[model samples]
Target: MTDPWNPADPGVLRLPSGRLVRGRGLRRPLDGSAPTPSYALYLLGRQPPPVTWEFRWIRWPDFRLPADRAEARAALTEAWERAAGERVEIACGGGRGRTGTALACLAVLDGVPAEEAVDFVRSHYDRRAVETPWQKRYVRRF
Candidate 1:
């Protein structure tokens, strides 16, 4: 298992179309001992400054899609569009669960069979990803 406190180095998940997206978890300092991380972070771009990719936040703890589905869709669409130009990142508190769910959705968008996405995330990213039973169900819905 990953340390959870320390996220893995980001990577590109190449879609069948040759586009790419990065995935990870943005978490509050685990040292604080808070119940959960503040929010999920999904960013689109390469390293360093002047990155062209966009960024979005999904509130954690609750784990609902953004209040504005359109915004969420727009974010994903932009990520999809920019996937060829830059790396896109999807993250949650533990680099699992919410992050995994979002990554699975990206896999769906990438043309991976939706049913296989959860397992893909588990095998590739972190085994603990998509932690909750409902979270696994959510990935299927994507």
Candidate 2:
């Protein structure tokens, strides 16, 4: 699996429409050379620190589930739309669980079958992705 935070890597996923989106971990310092995202989705249990880039937060606890399903869907759909025309990123504390889950959802939005999205992200991004069963189920339901 590629290091999601690596500037050279970006851990990008190319959608069926040819749009690219990146997934990353907020816990690690971002690589200075990485391309700056025009928009970002930060999935965390609490509010994120202020940032200059346009961003949205989904109240998602680590190794757990999102606080609100409807909100998560709306935010993820927005992120997916933005990724079609701009650099977009989805991130979480460790970049594995929540980030992977979000990325899998994006994969589903990208035309991947929902049932396959989790495995798709795990193989393409990180082996340890989607750390919990519910996260996997969430991807399927996305």
Candidate 3:
């Protein structure tokens, strides 16, 4: 079995239930010092570059919602489930919008109220997470 992510890792966010999911920006260089994720979810409008580890890609354009809401749900749910016993990472080009939105949804799955999930992520992950008003609304309705 894979080991869990270090809560102190640069992009790791510890959910209220103690699951650790790392959210990152594809625009930034990955910190080489951090351990790689056992599984990852990449949110992008187009196919992303392949990696050595297992991964999934959702056609989620930058600053926008996922193209297939159902696919996003399944992918995020899988990511959250794996994070309990593996290092799972969720990433988008800029990481704040799509990544943050997905993280909030995972928060909801982890038992955070949908209305409060966004705040929970912003407080523990990035201060500017869930970038747009619609994204915040999405979290609320998740």
TM-score of each: 0.63, 0.91, 0.97
Candidate 3 achieves a global lDDT of 0.91
Expressed as tens digits, the lDDT of each residue in 95-136 for candidate 1 is: 666667777777788788978988877776667777777767
lDDT of each: 0.55, 0.85, 0.91
Lowest summed lDDT window (length 10), candidate 2: 1-10
Model 3 per-residue lDDT tens digits across residues 53-89: 9999999988889999888989999999999899899
Candidate 1 ranges with C-alpha deviation above 4 Å: 1-12, 28-54, 62-70
Residue 142 displacement (Å), model 1: 1.6
Candidate 3 to native Cα RMSD, angstroms: 0.9
Candidate 1: C-alpha lDDT: 0.55
Residue 90's lDDT within candidate 3 is 96
lDDT by residue (17-101, candidate 2, tens digit) is 6667788888887778666678899999999988888999999999998999999999999988877677788899999999999
On a 0 to 100 scale, what is the lDDT of residue 8 in model 3?
Answer: 85
List candidate 3 segments past 4 Å from native: none
Worst 10 residues of 1 by lDDT: 1-10
